[model samples]
Target: MRFDIPLPDDTARLEALAHLDGLVKPVGSLGRVEELAAWLAAAHGSMPPRPLDDVRVVVFAGDHGVSDPAGPHGAVSAYPREVTASMVRVFLAGTSGVTVLARQVGARVRVLDIAVDGELADVPAEVTAHKIRRGSGSIDVTDALAPGEAERALAAGMAVADAEIDAGADLLIPGDMGIGNSTVAATLVAAVLGLPAEDVVGTGTGVNEAGRARKVAAVRAALARTADRASDPLSTFTALGSACAAATAGFVLRAAERRTPVLLDGVFSCAAALVCAELAPEAPRWWLAGHRSTEPSQAFALKALGLTPLLDLGLRLGEGSGAVQAVPLLRSAQAVISEMGLLADLA
Candidate 1:
């Protein structure tokens, strides 16, 4: 997969900086908020970006065989695999963490069952339209997806992004919902960054010490098995990531290609961003780290991408909760840029 993503507009960013300095405040009073305003302006290719009126958060749901209770290594997450489907229902019912926060920020939430292991009943057809498989292969012992399945998942993600942008979404947040996804995400990060398992593994979903050890072993095994493919982002993801993650990578890459800003949430999205950066080195220009997740892999990925996060709330809940929380802050920055008076006007 090839993407010729153009960097965000530099002229607009410089102009935004100058505008911020001219505002009725000290030159550096706003600190990071000013930086956020300039990034929005640059991403939108305007001095002051239009309000984030139609923000959309797309949650890519899936299942991982490595999390199977019957698998050789047993479950890696605190929650069972069935929770993936149950959370999908919760998201559809508009009661999940992301949904609740999205409402607060006036953003819409879309949940896609990309690789859910079980069939969801009584749900809208669009949610499962992009389903790649029941569950991804157990990455510790087998490839996460066949090459064809990986490509299809990526295409599905790109299509979803296009639809959202076409529907007038001003900002996008890519969320994730999958049991045992933390293991998959950590593995991908370890492989891409050439780090050891302990460096990236964490207590995903509040796993115990033994569970964390299991996750570390799984990540180490996955990295060793996929070592040769580490140089190729798609190949690495195909081996160590779930279909949902592949879709997330595709979604991020396409968003950057369209010059749309994306607020990345948690470790899964951070891992996906790493893969996208490998595919298109300039993709991070249109992306922002919504928060610093509790996952160590997220910190590693952010450092690698050279992007500082906006918040460090110790949030580990996936499904875009942290990003949704950060939405209001971005809007506040936009207000300062668009509505604040200039010092000259005060004179």
Candidate 2:
């Protein structure tokens, strides 16, 4: 679905500001929440804005070519491609905790396949296939994805966001699932935030001490291999990131253009956010950092982006689970702005 996000009308914004001024509260008493509500009202071309009731979480799943490298942090031994397809299946079956929490909060979860290899058997009806390539190119020795493939993955993400908005979704959560994605994510963070690979690489999906060391080494090697390329941010993604990272970056840009808020997941999601911020600096205003991960690199990325995480429960899971869990808190923030009576009125 093609969508053209309209800018806020001047008349509508003026009316919203007037309504906010006349509300039963001290001027600027509710602080940033009130400003956010007013901004939403203006974005919708309305006064006294209504709550954004519909929320959809779009999880993009793919595979990383870096998984085949001769490193200790390579793909887990128990499962290979099956793990990617299997976890997606679990999500579609509503058996995963993320699905449970989303259902509890009345949010719809949509899974998108961007670059997984092979066809999924008995695919659930909710999963949408938007594959750009069978899988990304190997980043251990070559570019992660072709430049054209990077654009295609980005367009695929924007397409999903457009479709969800047409179906009445006013807020979006872009999640990711791909084994060995932390390698790509770490590379992206290092390139954008100007940090060394050691500061941005971390143990993803519960890697142990030895595995963590291996992961860090793999990232450093990749960074060293790509040090001389003077490419732009998009080139950085195509060179060293996965489809999930590229798509998530596009989703954030599209969401910001539409003035819709986005809930971000962990390191991968934050990597995407950093890319989106590079593409459009104002995009950060529409983002809410969901949680801080147990991964040290995630903390560094968050700090570099100047974000204060809403929760820090030692979460290291990166399948949008942490972000989904924080949805209620976002709603509560909105509620405080929309429903609370002002102290001045009470007095």
**Model 1: lowest-lDDT 10 consecutive positions:** 225-234
Best by TM-score: 1
Candidate 2: C-alpha RMSD to true structure equals: 3.7
Error of 1 at 334 (Å): 0.8
**In model 2, which regions exceed 4 Å deviation?**
1-49, 69-81, 124-128
Q: Residues 53-156, candidate 2: write the lDDT tens digits.
A: 89788888888777754543465222365577778888888877678878888888887778776567678544646777667766766788886877877787
Off by over 4 Å in 1: 228-230
- Compared with the true structure, what per-residue lDDT tens digits does model 1 show for residues 165-275? 999989999999999988888888888888999999999999999999888888888787767653587777778888999899889888999989999999999998898
Q: In candidate 2, how many Å is residue 249 off?
A: 1.1
**Candidate 1 lDDT for residue 260:** 91
lDDT of 2 at 60: 87
